[model samples]
Target: MSGKAIVAHANLDPYERTIVVSDIHGDNQGFLETMRQVEFSPQDALVIVGDLLEKGEHSLELLHTVMRRAQAGNVYMVAGNNDTIFSEWYNDEVTDEEVHDYMNHRKNIILREMALEMGMSWQTLEEVRALKAAVPKRYAAELDFLNSLPHILETEHFIFVHAGLKPGPLTEQDRDFCLTAKAFGTQLHRFEKPLIVGHWPASNYCETIINVNPYFNRNTNVISIDGGNGLNRWHQINYLILHREHIDFGAYDALPRFRALDSQEPSKDPLTLGFPSTEAEVIRKGETESICYLPAIDLEIPVANDQLYNYKGKRYCYNMTTYCLPVQAGEILACCDVEPRGLLAKRNGMVGYYTGRYEFLSSDDLLLKKEGKQP
Candidate 1:
């Protein structure tokens, strides 16, 4: 398929609502729940802001689900960065050498996991090449659908794009600006239309917004609805409802899970695990006791002889053999510091240092905690 400009105009009646969502990344369950919560009907329009494929396990399924919906009702999608990359691969813009290099040496654990899910063996570059060759054949329909997606969709009151447009009129914007730009150079109030986007997570701009739950930039007329789905357990699928003269927010719960392949060895590569690196060495507190960070699992696994060490009002004792502790997704950890390292935490009952951030906390649970209520 050749690159083409797809600009769709949605003409809706007064009672119809336009629901926009972004960055699904293959969270099929979350997407279904969002649809069910809204009680989606034939009258309501659905707009996806991109990054629909990759990362999660059910990307192919999610693509089919959206395609089916598009046939039945008004549904539109903007091509995202991941969609662009996959398009390149499908259109032969991505060479076999590049795929080989990515599979063998690239530090992108998510991509590697995705390749494994697509039937590529993790052992060799030849397997990567085979998978690349077979993808176009296996997912020809999906690839064609992805390649056909537009970069921008405009209406009378709103400009819906995967990311943000460049610093000019919509007609003058390029594909990169629409599909990949992370931030608008200036506030979009000059355009006189609200620009709905998904790419940057709402949590990234939480500090600046009064209601961080749905991340809206009132000054710019830009609304970001990506809840970081597929990034971790803390994020969810967020949807923005555009009605007559108003916009509302709806979120669906999305919990992170260990990728099928990564679940087996959750901490095999500490450097490429997408966490910050630290140089703090293991210090031996005394004989048969050592305070150390395990590179395999990205957690501080303290070792003590038989007595407890009191530090910062938390008691720590060695419970298992050194370098044997394992960490997985969905495990709750009480952390004292949000830093990548140097955290005093408790999992179950044992006390140690947790390296993961509270950013992984569920949004619904966080709201309850903030309101002094139990979830």
Candidate 2:
């Protein structure tokens, strides 16, 4: 997950609002252009949904721009699947060569296949590899920030997630689904809030289904701001503005400002999972004596520390402790670097903070029975 900077007017007068965007995908130039075109006011808050790299010519440039925006306290970002892959590689967990291999494979297979389906000239593996090599080391912080970012954000009236929730026990999975282009069908009206997603490219036939029509149902808020960069058909970026009262939109009709950082596609996995969802849960029935466990992925084994039990599961690694609350199924937890701080989410309810993993409850089976909870 990347760092987010919130910008709002001190008074938040009637016109003050936040602007949300989907999948910049390295279109930093377009992003700036769109902001200028929309006459972005300092009073506005800009939130980028994620997937800002991996398919453009100005990834590093875009990264610098994003950091400047954050530093200026104007913009924030949620980690997209594409951003996840770049983060791992930026952290050196995945090498540049390995990324190139994946991109070459994707180019030769998936991308080419899609191009053929669309009757367009296929982008070659060489072109993709070159694009990856073009990424400079200057964007390291931005990439790390992207990797460390969260999947969802909450405001007074709306909730912003890179990907929407999935009907499962995993919270990250839902976010990942919302960050990709897989399901833009007849089932877009399922979510309760105004879901702003990017990842899926724009399509004429699927326009109504893909993008949220906030005008029809002021309450039925669903928006897809990815204007489909990196293709022969479209070259625009959409920016959405929303606040307590209403919402609006803007678009940038220029080429992308950055290059793809690597050939690897975004990570398909979501980052939020494994914990409680409320402050009350963290405060509930905690023992005086405390222990914590940081869960591990299948490849990483959990190590016990004090009362902490680092639980390595089939999917993700999480921390568990006696001080931690029992985790209900479908809850996603993100451990914080700040001592005694971790984020807990039950389905999609309000996100909560816990002191340690001891508060996590783990039975052989945990069942989740909610549509969406907080943090």
lDDT over C-alpha atoms for residue 344 of model 2:
26
Per-residue lDDT of candidate 2, residues 1-375 (tens digit): 322222121223334777777766666677787778777787777778777765765655676688887876666677667667655554676666666576554432222333343454424546544544433343346445665577766555655666554533223354435455353422345555566666654332232122212212233355555556553223456676666657766555532111111122122222222222101111122332222222322122222222232233322122222123334433343222122233322111111233322322332212211122111
Name model 1 segments beyond 4 Å from true: 1-6, 101-123, 184-189, 208-212, 254-375
lDDT of 1 by residue, 94-132 (tens): 876676775566443334555556756745667766776
- Cα lDDT, all candidates: 0.60, 0.46
Residue-pair clashes, model 1: 0
